[model samples]
Target: MRAVHHLRGAAAAAALTLLAVSGCAEKDGGGGSGAIQVTASDSACKVSRTEFPAGHVKLAVENKGSKVTEVYIYAPGDRIVTERENIGPGTKADITAEVKAGSYEIACKPGMKGDGIRQKVTATGQGSAKPQDPRLDRSVAEYRKYVQAQADETLPKAEKFAAAVKAGDIEGAKKTYAVSRVGWERTEPVAESFGDIDPKVDVREDGLEQGQTWTGWHRLEKALWTDKKIGAAEKKLADQLITDLKDWQKRVGTAEINATSMANGAKELLDEVATGKVTGEEERYSHTDLVDFHANVEGAHKSYELLRPVAAERDPALAAELDKQFKALFTLLDKYREKGSPDGFAAYDTVGKDDRKELSDAVNALAEPLSKLAAAVAS
Candidate 1:
């Protein structure tokens, strides 16, 4: 609670600094209408042009792979400009996105996954700034509010969870741990925007190096569930996680949000579920992977909802179809919910391979529709 109050006070104090620059970013969005042709296969990622002036860049992606494929345009910092996914063999689709002047990679994922074959493209000159798309601007505003709300929800839960551990109430901490993860999982993409905070707050035990600061959720999880004790050092780390959460919210609130980011983040959250939760690898100690999975879905759904109107305007049927897919995915997930609440869900080890497969299939089902979102809504 103190953390939340402090965040509100800090936010109010910095209102002028944050809100003054809050509206549409003066970013050099790709507003150009010219289409760049790309061809994808098992061995290659080929593009019609190596570079174009930064503004609105359109791509016509043709997947020649025997298996399903995906293509992405990545900026220098591994930021996703845009991507098109689940293109069947011999299928073609258009991907459009706004890019600033920078070096980028056009990557083709041939077998539907892997570090893809990449070709470099450079945008040399600043193309003229066209007016920001009002729909995208509205989506960005809504996303910011969503992130802020998630952040606000995060601090209090985190504080209580941390306090439980520090007080050596192991059972109480176990109960609170799943409850606290909702905001953290939902806003993970937003939290990861700041370079250092995400690692500090969420990095797994396997990720830690020799003699580095052992903090964040997983470290505490290991202590509570594995070691079955929280000593002075672990207690200190618990307190630090709360303080970091407070600082984390302040930094993320001021960062920019746009269509590509929102769409990419939604996809990334699904990927997070696939890579960690579905694999039963994330909550290795507690086996509470379903909690994170549900939270990620909630976050991704929010991101999609932010773009719903624009997607509806672009193609009404596509929008409606996506809505149906989302509903179906939630229905499938609901069966896994413990006591029919989002906060409680089936333990990871309790789910057999068959159960995991069904969840995976549902996720993949929703992912195909979601993969189209960024490209569809791109200006």
Candidate 2:
């Protein structure tokens, strides 16, 4: 499996292109009352204030680093309320979010990589203590349960695949490999939520840290698909994967949830599709990009479904437009599926360049409508 480290950079570029497309219709400003001034440099993440009155807030971010940076307002439990991305050096951008009274974190990624430097921020107000958007709350809670269920499925299936490798059965491991990824693909954000474990668990060979032992899915993937043999080292990699995923399962069991997370998680899922899955980069070894593509769509659709009520309640026309776009994307995806995969998805190689470009266009269209979702759900 090739290292897919380029996905984040590519996704950031896509986000910027969309931002420019939308900004053509308007201009950004200092924002309204309670706008927090944020500055990012190679060394630090700074905020104008650590406390706010709660409710609607804006993060007016300035990037001073040489590299591209993005700022995120994170709620408790790794939930990011809002974020502004693709801010190059000397660039200014802002993200407005409806934040309730609670503890939060602000993270700045100078190179658009890793967890980033973080600062703590809080909002204080009588209303902040109370739950906002009961409907959205239910949606987030239900989404978390969905994540838990996916985790439950992922752990054992991964174990089973690992078991095959541990037995030195390369064919058996390859047979179960795609099935093992189903849970992890559906609940990717949860894997990403755990600070460092994510890299150890999912980092591709190209993504390995210097001097760090490569013992995860991609490492094992190479053995099964490239080497066509599972050695003792490969078996040990399998053991480590199980170890890390077990931690992933435990951490997600106690994880937090909110409407903002649901909105962003949906975007992240689509970003996965646009960045790696669409290009057939993620499944370089197994040619299983279609499997991941379908899973990403499924996960994104679930996230969008959870936030549909809030968006619809705010703007019926926009909601209908988004629903139509969603169906259009899904209808295109439907053609690729048949009696094949464990989930009935054909391989990524089945699609030609023209079909791939068409699918990519569909993802971009959906992203435009999906970008407005967080604002519509905002209080």
Candidate 3:
């Protein structure tokens, strides 16, 4: 049951003031094809080049590990410049990110846990900060506003869920549980940027670090559904959940967001769905995986749509492919909806193997094209 998704989280960092969208192209300095080669094995992380010119950089990553792995480009203070997750064994990806002149680490998290193996590198020379396109500016602003709105809507729903738990109403808490999570799931990339908040509010039991207390939504979820009772401890945790989420609500305004991050974040949502929801690891007890699945798709689609104008302008073919894949995935997901269900989707546990396979296939289809989004917008 300890899938690759159980261990994903990010720390907080200041907003990157530099404006540059990502697109794969020829290397700025003297390098072949302009992509830094990254090889991630079980024991080591290797980068072909130690440094590159600031502006747009590409890391062509290959996972040689036996287990799934994720790669992150962290600025000096662990601020994520850009990252690619759920790179399964023997797979490869070309990740494009915007970087300024500074030191950074290319980290490989094999098995998707812990501090990750790091490779130090520097962004030499000046960064490309001039506005590439006015459309991208609009894209960033609109995405930020959308993230804020999701946060604004989440607080009230989470409060209601907390209240229901405190009042010792199992059925009431269950009803509100998936509803409260929709907003958070939709904008997890933003929410996860705050280092201390994500684990506090959303960490799964298996994802917990040693000595870390399990106190988020999943903890309470187990109590409500599996344990089937809310005692004093559960009530206290309910209050703690609200406090932690409110911290996330307050910090949403400060998250590091950019055109590249938005594009990367959209891809991250698909990773979340593939690793966690599609596998039935998330929302395990309540079987609300589909609810989370829907939200993840919605969030990813929001990012894609906002960046569509620019993406389409840069690469029309990729844009059309993305539209088709997104529609196909959404259409498949729509088949699972149920009017009688609390979350408007059939229980995940009841989903047949054939159906789950179909869902996973559709997600993979969308993710493959979606992965190229950063490079498309970069142009």
Residue-pair clashes, model 2: 1
lDDT of each: 0.70, 0.70, 0.79
Against the correct fold, how does model 2 do in TM-score?
A: 0.76
Q: What is the Å distance of residue 260 in model 3 from its true position?
A: 1.4
List residue ranges in candidate 2 displaced over 4 A: 1-34, 37-56, 61-69, 72-84, 87-93, 97-127, 194-197, 341-343
Pairing residues by index, what is the TM-score of model 3?
0.88
TM-score against truth, every candidate: 0.75, 0.76, 0.88
**Clash number for each model:** 7, 1, 6
RMSD of each: 8.0, 6.4, 3.5
| TM accuracy, model 1 | 0.75
Backbone clash pairs for candidate 3 read 11-195, 12-195, 22-378, 23-375, 23-378, 27-34
Ranking by TM-score: 3, 2, 1
Q: After superposition, how far is residue 237 of candidate 2 from its true place, in Å?
A: 1.6
lDDT string, candidate 3, 139-255, tens digits: 888988898888889999999999999999999999999999998888864554565677778888887867988988999999999999999999999999889877877776777
Best by lDDT: 3
Estimate candidate 2's alpha-carbon lDDT, on a 0 to 1 scale. 0.70
